[model samples]
Target: MQLSEQCVLITGGARGLGHHLSLAFAREGAQVIINYHRSAQAAQALAAQLGPRQAIALQADVTDPAQVQAMLATAAGHFGRPLTTVVNNALAAFSFNGDARPKADAIGWDAFQSQFEGSVRGALNTVQAALPAMRAQRFGRVINIGTNLFQNPVVPYHDYTAAKAALLSLTRTLAGDLGPDGITVNMLSGGLLRSTDASAATPEAVFDYIAANTPLRSVTTPAEFADAALFFASPWARAVTGQNLVVDGGLVRD
Candidate 1:
C-alpha cells in the first residue's frame, strides 16, 4: 500500500526510536497512531506536532491484549479507517550497558520473559488485534523491530538478544502465513544506535568503537533506521516479505 493510504500504529511511539518512526510516517502522509506506555506528554506533543489530521497519540501497554485491542479500535474510529500498518517497536525497560548487564550465568528467566513479553508478546497482541481489519481490506503491513546482536552478538545481551531472536522467527512465519492475505511481515534490525533511551547507558567509547568499525564509519541514528521502516509499509516492498533487513550501516554483512 502507498503511504498516503495507510494508517499506521507504532507501539511505544512517544520516545526513543519510536519517536522518529512516528515523525517519518507522518511526513510520508500516513495517519499515525502513536501508542505510548508511559510517555503520555511526549506522545501528545508529537501528535500535536504532526497535527490532528495526520497523527494521534493513544495510550496502551502493548503487552496487554485488552488495551491493545481498545487502542486499535479507537485508532480506527479516529481515522475513519482500519490501521493498514503496524510497527512493533515497544521495548521493555532496558539499558544497553554491557558492563551492567546481568551475566548469562546470573541472569534469571524473568529477564528473558520480560523481554519476550515486550518484543514477542506485544507484537502478538497488536497483530492479532489488527488482523481482521487487514484481512478484510486484503492488505496489511507488519514491521517488527529487531537487533543485530543475533548475528554479531558483540555485547552478548543474552536476555534482550534472545527475545529479539524469537521475534525474528515470528516475523518470518507471519510473512509466510499473511502473504496470502495481502499482508507483508518483515524485520528491520539495527546495531547499537548512536543515541536512544536504551542506548544512553552505553559507553561513549563503545559507540566510537562501533562507528569506527562500521562500513559507513558512523553509528546509525534512530531517524535513519526509522526511515527504512517506511519501505516495509510502502508499495516498493509489496513483493517482499519474510526478510530481515539490517539497518546498522552494514555492520553485520549477512
Candidate 2:
C-alpha cells in the first residue's frame, strides 16, 4: 500500500519511537490511528496536533482481542476506511537500566512470560484483529518492532530479547501464510535508540560505547529508525516479507 492510501494503526503510538512514527506517516499523507493503552492525553494531543482529519487517538489493551477489535472498529469509523497497515511497536513496560535488571540466576519464567504478553501476545492480537480487513482488501502491511539485542545481546536484556526473537519467528511464519493475500509481514530491529523514555535510564557511557563501535559512529535515533519502518509498508517493499532489517547503523550484520 502507498503512504497516501493507508490508514495506519500504530500500537503504543503515544510516545517514544511510536510517537515519531505517527508523525512520520502522517507527514507523508497517511491517515493515522494512534493507539495508546494509557497515555490518552499524549495520544490525543498528538492526534490533535496532526489535526482531526489526518489522525485520531484510540485506547486499547493490545493484549486483549476484544479491546483490539473495539479499537479497530472505532478507528475505521473515524477514517471511513479499513486500516491498510499496522505497526506493533509497543514495548513491555521496561527500562533500559541494565544494572537494575534481574541477574540471570534471579530471572524466572514469569519474567519472560510478562514480556511475551506485552510484546508477542500483543502483536498476535493486533495482527489477528486486523487480518480480516487486510485480507478483504487484498493489501496489508504488518510491521513488528524488534530490538538488535537478539543479534548482539550487548546488555543481555534476556526477557525482552527472547520475546522479540519469538516475534520474529511469527513474522516469518505469518508472512508465508499471508503472502498470497498480499499482506507483507516483516520486523524492524533497532539498537538502543537515542533518548527515548525507555532508554532514558541508560547510562551515558553505554551510549558512547555503542556509538564508537557502530559504523555510523553514533547510536540510531527514533525518527531515523521509524523511517525505515515506513519503507516496509510502501509499495517499494512489496516484494519483501519475513525479513528483519537492523536499523542499528551496521552494529550487527544479519
Candidate 3:
C-alpha cells in the first residue's frame, strides 16, 4: 500500500523505536494509531504532536488477544476504514543492558517463557486479530520488529534471541499462508539500536565497537530503521514477504 493510502497501527508505538516509526508514517501522510500498554500519557502527547489528522493513541496490551482485537476495532472506527497496515512493534519488558543479564546456565524455562509470550505470542494475537480485516480487503502489511542477535549472538541474550527466532519462523510460514490474500509479512531486524528505551542502558563502548566493526562505520538510528520499515510496507515491497531485513549497518549479512 502507498504510505498515504495506509491507516497504520503500530503496537508499542508510544515511545522508543515505535515513536520513530509513528513519526515516519505520519510524515508520509499515513493515519497512525499509536498503541501503548503503559505509556498512555506519552502516547497521547505524541498523537497530539503528530496532529489529530494523522495520529491517534490507543491503549492495548499486545499480550492480550482480546485487547488487541478491541484496539483494532477502535482504530478502524476512528479512521472510518479498516486498517491497511499493522506494525507488530510491541516488546515485552526488556532492557539492552547485557551487563545485568543472566548467564546461559543461570537462565531457566520461566525466563524463556516470558520472552516467548512477549515476542511470539503477542505477535500471534495481533496478526490473528488484524487478519480478518486484511483478508477482506486483500491488502495488508505486517511488519515485525526483530533483532540481529538471532543471526549473530554477539551477546549472551539467549532467551530474547530464541523467542525472536520463533517469530522469524512465523513470519516465513505465515507469508505462505497469507500471500494469496495480498497480505505480506516480513521482519525488520536490527542490532543494538544506538538509543531507545530498551537500548538506553547499552554501554557506550558496545556502541563504539559495533560501529567500528560495521561497514557503515556508524550506529543506525531508530529513524534510519524506521525509514527502511516504510519500504517493507510500501508498493516497492509488494513482491517481498517472509524475508528478514537487517538494518545494523552490515553487522549481520542476512
- Clash numbers, per candidate: 0, 0, 0
| Per-residue lDDT over 1-254 for candidate 1, one digit per residue giving the tens place of the 0 to 100 score | 78998999999999999999999999999999999999999999999999999999999999999999999988888899988999999999999999998887899999999999999999999999999999999999999999999999978699999999999999999998999999999999999887999999999999999999999999999999999999999999999999999999989998
TM-score for candidate 1, residues paired by index = 0.99
lDDT of 2 by residue, 28-133 (tens): 9999999999899999999999998999999999999999999999988888999899999988799999989988989998989989999999999999999999
What's each prediction's TM-score?
0.99, 0.98, 0.98
CA-lDDT, candidates in order: 0.94, 0.93, 0.91
Most lDDT-accurate candidate: 1
Model 2: residue 205 alpha-carbon error in angstroms:
0.3
> Candidate 1: where are CA atoms >4 Å away?
none
Please provide, for model 3 over 1-254, each residue's C-alpha lDDT reduced to its tens digit, 9 standing for 90 to 100: 68998999999999999999999999998999999999989999999998877888999888999999999898888888888898988888888888988997798889899999988998899989988889999999999999998879978888999999999999999999999999999999998887999999899999999999999999999999999999998999999999999999999986
In model 3, which range of ten residues has the least summed lDDT?
Answer: 149-158
Off by over 4 Å in 3: none
Candidate 1, pairs of clashing residues: none
RMSD of each: 0.6, 0.8, 0.9
Candidate 2 segments exceeding 4 Å error: none
Q: What lDDT score is found at residue 164 in candidate 2? A: 94
